[model samples]
Target: MSTLTEELANTDLLWDVPQATLEFLAEHSAPRTLASGEVLLCPELENGHVYLLLTGTLTVHFGTPDSPMIRELAQGSSVGEVSIIDDTRPSAYVIAKETCRVFPIHRHLIHQLLAESNPFARNLLQMLTRWLKSNTQRIVSDRMQIWELTDQVNIDGLTGLYNRRWLDNAFPRLLTQSWKKGQALCVLMVDVDNFKSYNDDNGHLGGDRALMAMGEVLKTTVRPYDFAARYGGEEFLILLPNTSLNEGVAVAERIRHCSESKAVAYANEHSVPGITVSTPLPNITVSIGLALNQSDSVSELIAAADAQLYRAKMDGRNCVRY
Candidate 1:
């Protein structure tokens, strides 16, 4: 096996350096062995040396040691360079992914090499540039992943509308804003009329398509500032800010009308092999219950709208009740 000096000579940081310099670095640096899962660096602690990975792998984690790793450092990769360069605590945790060996070059020696060796300075700069580029790409990729995950968590899969989970988080904040501003807010609790019968006749797939169509109608019909979400199975909720009961009722009527008129087109699942057929589903209607915000609490507003919704269902479906 190669000695620590030989490994140092092959690293990007010491490339093209004189043998005398490499010998000096080896003399000053000490070899350290790390077990798997060892924490090599942390944001809360200061790192005084730059570590050169001689064998095995290391992982960089942004948050905690147990958090998902953001980057992997293989053999020939360097660690703790950023904190040494900036003279600050490490910004992330570096942990050994497996049993590894590293050469730790102290900060004093690093500064000495930077001052004395032109090649060392050039190589360090190049290494830092590559590190920065990779970090930038990783950041962009992570952001995109986070956005997609957030969308998936908050949106209903069948309807393509915001799900109840999103509503639970958002409705309280919206209600608070309206209350603080002393502006009117209305909640519409909408449900599909005789939805079980429709599902019984057309099957669950058809019911899903109908819900998707309803989602689209709400997306197109609601004002820009209004919020809509799938409350639960076959039930949806709409929030209109700065609107009175009359305005809420008008919006509900429009939604009801649109739902009644729209026809959902779906592929016939029972189609014969090798032949595709598209059919328009029978039109559906909605019962809407509107309640203007008279209470400060989110639960109270929702409860009031729910009561009205029950009334609409009792008064015969397909109409709005306020």
Candidate 2:
């Protein structure tokens, strides 16, 4: 069992606390271990305990449990402080990415420390200020809005990926940055093979599910900095910054294989109130076209990818063209 004073000494939040306060904290805090995939905190939970991470990784997600991750915290980082400070339910989910060891500082201990120790109080104030600033920046960059109207802007509601509007605005800037950095830029246009026929055989609802699955595949396959969008309908676009054409083609093939082996499982609605049936969709295939940034303009690069996509469709669907 690691003492709280020893743990607090390594953490940023308690860096400047006096030795006495650290001793008090160590005496009050207890060691805790969180296993991988365990949720440490969530929105509805009103627990007023903040934790100091000792080992492994934790992921913070806003909105819902399945929402996009906003931050990843490592050892020596603090978790749940915002909720504790605000005296409100957590607005985010903190999940352990791997096995984690933590020391939890409950609200009562925190209040006692703050009342007895001026240095501890000051350190907490500084930490809260920095946390607020960091969170504000993330909210702006993520386009995660609190209001309803601003929510319509950056993301695709159906796929939960960046929308065409975001792509249109971001691509040019990405291209410029790549050029300035002398890095390769690769673009891929992906299309679901025999999608129209599948839609005809299945319903539009089936088509929607197929599209959503494809979006998820793309989301998982791309790098963190890579931009992916549902470029309208069954067509999806991926932008690979600092990636060679060869690397991009390889990524496309990996996505292709992943999609090929994957099945979409859905349920059927029956007219009979009590009856329901489950269906497993056939493994889906996608045609991919990859292009390196060969021209000065973003439009030219997209057009090259489009041309390659056409070529892929022509050269027997379910293939990659570059």
Candidate 3:
């Protein structure tokens, strides 16, 4: 293995530093060994020295110990520079991604090096700049990744509509808002007519495209204040605030007519080899059920809409019932 001074001489941060200053760092710095998954700095607890990574990798995370990682420090990288320079608590947790060795450089030692060599000072400034820039880019990248993951969690991938998970989370809040503002609330339950038979005649892929088309129709039909979501397979729901039963029924009828009049098409250019689909697919009809918010719970309101939906199906499909 190379001696501490030998390793320090190889590092860009220290390469331009004078031999005398490098010797000072080799003498003052203490070696550290971390096990895989070992935590070096806890954002909530520690505010301390920077580390010169000699071997292995370190990951940085914000928010909590189990939070998503924001950045990684590779071999020959510096860690904790941001906290050391600012003289504040670290905004992130630093952990070892694998067994690692590091040199913990204290603030006093850094100050001594600054005084000893102008080259060392310049090198340190450059190192800090690179660290800051890298961290800023990582933060932005991490934010975008987090947003995409959150969207995947709340949105239906097949139809590009809000999923049942989002509806369950958001409906209570919407109901509370309506109650507080003394405004009416309404729910529309929509289902494709004979979707089972449709899926049997046309494959699941065709059914998916049909559902996607229905989703688009609802997207273009609803008002800006309205909320629409895929309740489950072949079922959709819309929430309308400040809408009466009559208004809700009218919206449901409009959606029903629109769905009946439209044709769905599917063709994926990027589909697997030898996999192809027909375009300008068949037209389909839908049955809609409406219910106004009553002096009852959300479940009861949904049940009311479901009951009306059954009535619509019994009265023959492609119609709205309330």
Candidate 4:
């Protein structure tokens, strides 16, 4: 078998290191053997030494040892260097992928090498720079994936509008902002009038087209700062900031008229064979309930608007109520 200094000379991190420095490192550091699945470093634990892999493979995991691997280290790779350099705990778990041999260089010895050996310092700095770049790219990729997933979760697939889940998460923040700024905030509960009867007459597909058209109308009718979301089947909600009771009523009337005049185009199910035909569906109307924020509570504001909606539905539908 070769001497420890000869073994150290073959490793990438120790390459070009002077013979005396290698001899000193070999004399001070000891070789450690780890079994498969052994934890070499953990985020919650302090690591005082940098490890140089001499045989087999190791893996880095962010959350736990059994979690998906974030990175892999080969025989020439080094681990636990960041913790020693920054005097901080490890940021992730390093595990032995299989039976492996590593040389554990203590922090004091690493500092000595940095001060005494120019080649060792240069090699370490190069390794750290590469690691930094790799980590930055990984963080950016993760953020993009998280944003995509959040958008998918918060949007309604059928109407391409914000869903109830998004509204629930956002309403409290909007309410807080209004309270802090002392600005008026209004809530509108808009419901499709005679929706069940319309569904019975036009079938589910026609009803779906009508709802989609209604969604487009709301998106275009609301102000740039206003928020619109699908509250539930056949119902939608809108939030208007910096608006009084009068302005809220005016906005609600606009939505009601827009819904009443809008005609949806869909494929006629009764079209003749071998030819497709497009037909305009009958117009649909909406009953809107408006309420200004008086209680300074999200649930209270929504409840007040919902109560007005019930009144609108009771008073022969197709009208705005406050």
Candidate 5:
């Protein structure tokens, strides 16, 4: 590390160093103190400063609909690097998690830092590397999280799949195409049997876990090009273009069977019991209902699946009623 760089690390603001590429910040860089809980970088909002926390913690969050717990930043953790690095929208909301102090470099200062210093260059490279690394990790983590989050709007949160919203947006177009082609339009409504009790008995969180698991079940069991999404709390809707009611039901049964065989670790349990009385509940099961809409509006299709789902629940849990 350079002396300038080390100095840069100490003060609330890093002023001069050969590491920076531009000398113009000799005129513009300033310092500020951020009290705890202050918002520094808003996810959906915009600001021009690249906030570098000199002390305390920061929390980074997203705009998810339900239980949107997100990232935390320690001292030395930087925010707004993406905006500084490129011209793009801010991807997350940031708040000072604790009493914090920061060096808020205006965009001009950022360009100066990039243009004038060596360590700044090195630091920029390192930050970029860190940024790239953080981004890559983010991509993987977000993919998994997108896999995990429930209650997504426009599409189903489970299955990492499309939903009624998708159909609402696409079905009209799809129907038009199908109408012109004189082809069969296959729409499936899939319900997890007794899911109300599944979530209710397990607790909402447990229900979320189950739904997430069920989503994976559908993804794995279905053929490519078939789209599925959590239609609502416990039911998922599927659309199979260019297929028959028979084909759609066939896929639904496979999904149902997969759910029955599918078992989750039963999160509410305490400790493992089998490995010398340590394993948790052995498994949890799912029941499903299948309904197909071959010659009706999207509403009718969803209604049909929902009806079957109700029947499945009424008949028994863990069985598929098609």
Candidate 6:
């Protein structure tokens, strides 16, 4: 309802700014409106001006110059200042998502104001700098929070490893990188042998202990570059970079042997048989199959390794091979 300058005066954002300083900005900044589908600037080019949203909305976008991924902008938000300060590529394409009115404040005019009055200009600069700092901090905190939330969403409760979601997110990237590098990246699929019978015979508690031990073995036995994640129920997966099927099988064998050597203990009174402070239960076994990343599609790699795992189970539950 009110004019842009009137809105600025009432917003209280520039309340700390001196009266003379406000008069100078009034002369310098311009009120401009962009239609619903209009683009004020392509952030990829020069960050020509900074904008303060007076009314309406905008969208930050991705994609080609003509077609973009549009995301919303709220009222009272400022734009383009971040690019001016950091000199980095723009994070997204910003366009007027709706009929938006922006008060564009040119940096050249602000510099001129600085020359006109030292105290007033210094005060305004300090305020702007502080706002930018606070804004950057909030963005960083938000990203960290989102990362934690994503981890919780995409992680398996039973094995503390990446679940199906993460595989969907990362496997394609891995395949591309491996193909580009002309080096093999391998996937090793591991499963505890007779896990159902073990659960039936010893209970889920026994199966859990075995799972934990096997997870630990995978962590310790693999190369430094390898990443291991619980694939799903009674299943685990490991990524081996720059490795051939032969080398991958060797790593899988190491993990299998390590898990088999360690005995698992049950907390229940009679589940594991021999219960002691040091040693609580008998050793358990796992079977692992290695699939070369360069040689297989994501699904094919997983299936190949799984098929090999089935073979390991048939051969006798406690082995690892390519």
TM-scores for candidates 1 onward, in order: 0.80, 0.53, 0.72, 0.78, 0.46, 0.59
> How would you encode candidate 5's per-residue C-alpha lDDT over 1-322 as one tens digit per residue?
5433443464323433443422233235544678877777765666687776777888777773222546677766567867766767677777777788776777777776667555556666666687678779989987987765533655564457677676567766776676677777666566665566766677777677777777888788777876676666766666777777678667767776777677654445445664433222223565555554455466666676667767866776666666
TM-score of 1: 0.80
User: Of 5 and 6, which scores higher on TM-score?
Assistant: 6
Candidate 2 matches the true fold with a TM-score of: 0.53
C-alpha RMSD for every candidate: 3.8, 16.2, 5.3, 4.1, 10.2, 8.7
Winner by lDDT between candidate 6 and candidate 5: 6
lDDT of each: 0.90, 0.84, 0.85, 0.91, 0.64, 0.72
Per-residue lDDT of model 6, residues 198-245, tens digit only = 888777887787777766677678778777888778788888878887
lDDT of 5: 0.64
**Comparing 4 and 6 by TM-score, which wins?**
4
lDDT of 1: 0.90
The sequence of per-residue lDDT tens digits that candidate 4 reaches over residues 15-77 is: 899898887887787899999999999998899999999888999998877899999999978
Q: Poorest 10 consecutive residues of model 3 by lDDT?
A: 269-278
Worst 10 residues of 4 by lDDT: 1-10
Q: Identify the runs in model 4 with alpha carbons over 4 angstroms from their true place.
A: 1-12, 15-31, 43-48, 62-64, 88-91, 172-182, 261-281, 297-300, 307-317
Model 5 segments more than 4 A misplaced: 1-159, 266-296, 317-322
The residue-by-residue lDDT of candidate 1 on 1-322, one tens digit each, is 2377789887788888888998888777678999999999999988999998989999989878898888898998788888999999999999999999998999999999999999989999999999889889978998999999999999998888899999999998888989989999999999999999989999998898899999999998899999989999999999999998888888999999999999887766657988777799988899998898886898888888899999999998899998
Tens digits of per-residue lDDT for model 2, 161-230: 8899989888999998888888899999999999999888778878877877787888888889888898
lDDT of 5 at 140: 100
Please identify model 1 stretches exceeding 4 Å from their true place. Answer: 1-7, 18-20, 23-48, 54-70, 87-104, 268-275, 314-316
